[model samples]
Target: MAHLDTLDDEVPDISPYVTPISPTNRFYRIDTALTVPQVDPESWRLRITGLVDNPYELTYQDIRSMRLADYVITLSCVSNQVGGRLVGNAIWTGVPLYELLQRAGVQRGAQQIVGRSVDDFTAGFPTTLAYDGRNAILAIGMNNEPLPTRHGFPARIVVAGLYGYVSAVKWLEEIRLTTWDGFDGYWVPRGWSKQGPMKTQSRIDLPSHGSRVNSGETIPLAGIAWAPTRGIERVEVRIGNEDWTPCRLGQAAGNESWVQWHRDWTPSGGGRQQIQVRATDGSGHTQSGRTVPPRPNGAEGWHTISVDVR
Candidate 1:
């Protein structure tokens, strides 16, 4: 977690609103299984089975030839604690999972779309989310480049507004359709939520935590806010005894991506300053002030940060 620095005229607006992390940025990575498997693209195949009318398979080349869709999506882990750094944004390129499922002829009784990775790890979500107008993709490209090995090299699923545990299956190998009662992905039995809808979250990214600034110096307060598929409507920040003030929001790439925000602040008195930030989604839901630990579901509450002012 990088801290915010003293704002100077030469400093480019350090707000996420002014600049978003690039797709190729060093994103946080996690694997349920101990090992991250390396797969050969040429030999790999994506299997579609179970409740699909046409049980079939596609090789790397076969999938690449399909109509490729692009999206800038953010992925959050269900285990992300308050003010966690496990979330990231990327421009993903792939076939829409909804379209692929349609082409494969999903059977009428199919209730879940389960993704299987080469390592045998699996996770899934409701079948309706695939065709219900969400930007869910069987992603193969990231940041205009081939997906990186550490980030699910050959392919992965990019479903907006859901925690990675339920949606982002990395190093893909299969897509299986089944009844809701017939399946439990890797995380469900382990106590994570079955449907990992993302929680609205906001974070302070600048002025590295615990850093100091001179009293009365105007500083740039910047961070990012996200609500996934619903998008972010606004972000507000409160410093010391001040009332919440709206921060400027950056243009979002799509409903699934995050937006940067920032505000200029000058300290009235020196010592320690505590700041609280919250967000309202496009759906008109403001983040909860009540704090909850990340558990079966996502965490809820405002992110608070403190800094020193001499």
Candidate 2:
């Protein structure tokens, strides 16, 4: 785990509203309040209320008694840079959120579920996605190990097909069914788009900047790409705006994580060169050409980097 520097060096040099980058290198923000004093599961309680036929609360042991399943999931932060460190893959173990909601009996006209975290952060998600068959889990374990403190220790929410901001609530405290008009989440109130969907993107990992390679030797270039809830169908690499060549993509582990890819490139001569990577999802949606910041929605565009071949 790496720590990131997200604090403003001085008090008033920049805009006050700028989102503080997290000290943890992980893409997601770590709630300072709740994370300070490690939350204990034995003393934890999850409350379900508002617009439900049966308003109730459950203790940690009560939730643990429910059926549990393990799933491999990938989480990506909406504010992550083009090749940022705000993404990770883990095996999560938890009960489906839909099953719990069913027991609570959602009332009619409920379009969203407002999720609250122990740190007072809130996220509003469409109720249909929360109740439908899609795997929306209240995760208790990650990577077959107890949830790491930085990744939401006691519990966190993991929903497919949505961006991390709305789906990955850490140190979950309560879930309340409500109408869309009833609430606005942290990001939504800050001018970010209400709806979030992960975009298809790829990155190169091997032959890092200033790497040296033999003039005529074949260098292996490897990386990963993702289209959450969908599989990656193909990956292509281009050199200097030339024709794109297909790279070999490894078999996908699951629908929610990234797919690894590798390609071989032989340097004709020793010089500086640029490489670009792009990917296509199972649905055949190509990556976007326009570049957009991660604030309003997810970032988009091909990832490119320059390297030197000696």
Candidate 3:
């Protein structure tokens, strides 16, 4: 195993709030591994075992020969606080995990599918999710480039609508189906939600807080919103105690990808002012105003930032 970075919260710094597609180099990563595993594609083997009628292994070439699809998706770390910089969007290329599982033929008793990494790290989710219309895949490419060593080189796991802790297994070596009723991921025992569904969240990107913008001039307020399986329907911005105003959303590739939103705001009076943002998902659920920390699962509440107007 090679050395690894424990946690990286580095988000896009240049107009980060407006950039819809995050560059592969600027994406965030979180891991508990003390060292990253280096797996050679030529020597790699993906084994499917346990509770299956046709247990088999697939070589790297085997994976490449299968039909490949592009998944433009956004993923966020569970530890990210409200308005935190641990979220990113990228186009991942891989084969749908469902295809592999179907070929292996899951047994009747299988309840969960566990993905074990070369570094010995493991995380899995309910088997139902694999066939439940969610796009879970074994990602071999990130942003049109080969997967980075730090970001699961040969391949990794990406499941729509789920948090990274329970689904994003990197440097994958084996996928095993389990009938254990009490199976838990690495983070579950360490205090996290077992299911790990992602929560709807938004962030403010433009007009750095504390920077002064001239009053009477229209200032553009913008950011990004993500809801995974359920797309963001609308984004609303609040100025100080003013009523919520709708923001124009940019074109989105799909429901699984994050969308950009922006609205022009003209400061009424000079001095300090506050801006807050909230989002309503395609399922008609709006983000709550109640503030909560990102523990056990994900964070909650609107993203608020204060700015100075001259």
Among all windows of 10 consecutive residues in model 1, the one with the lowest summed lDDT is: 1-10
lDDT of 3 by residue, 134-193 (tens): 789999988888889999988889999998999999999988998756477788788887
Clash pairs, candidate 1, are: 3-207, 3-208, 4-206, 4-207, 4-208, 16-260, 17-260
TM match of model 1 to true structure: 0.93
Put down candidate 2 lDDT per residue, 1-310, tens digits, no spaces.
2111222232222222211221223434534353443678888889988889998998878877888888766667788778665666556789988888888999998888878888888887898887555678988876666677677777888887678787788888898898988888888988888877777777777667566677788877777778877868999988776899999866555667667677788877668888888899988988875777888888888788888777
Report the C-alpha lDDT of model 1 over 170-281, residue by residue, as the tens digit.
9999999999989999989998888889989999877668988888889888888889899999999999878999988776776788888778888777788898899999
What is the TM-score of each predicted model, taking all chains together? 0.93, 0.87, 0.94
The lDDT, on a scale of 0 to 1, for candidate 1 is: 0.84
Prediction RMSDs, each to the true structure: 3.8, 8.8, 5.6
Better of 2 and 3 by TM-score: 3
In model 3, how large is the Cα lDDT of residue 35?
A: 82
How many residue pairs clash in each candidate at the backbone level?
A: 7, 2, 0
> What ranges in model 3 sit over 4 Å off?
1-14, 180-182
Name model 1 segments beyond 4 Å from true: 1-18, 23-25
Best of the two (2, 3) by lDDT: 3
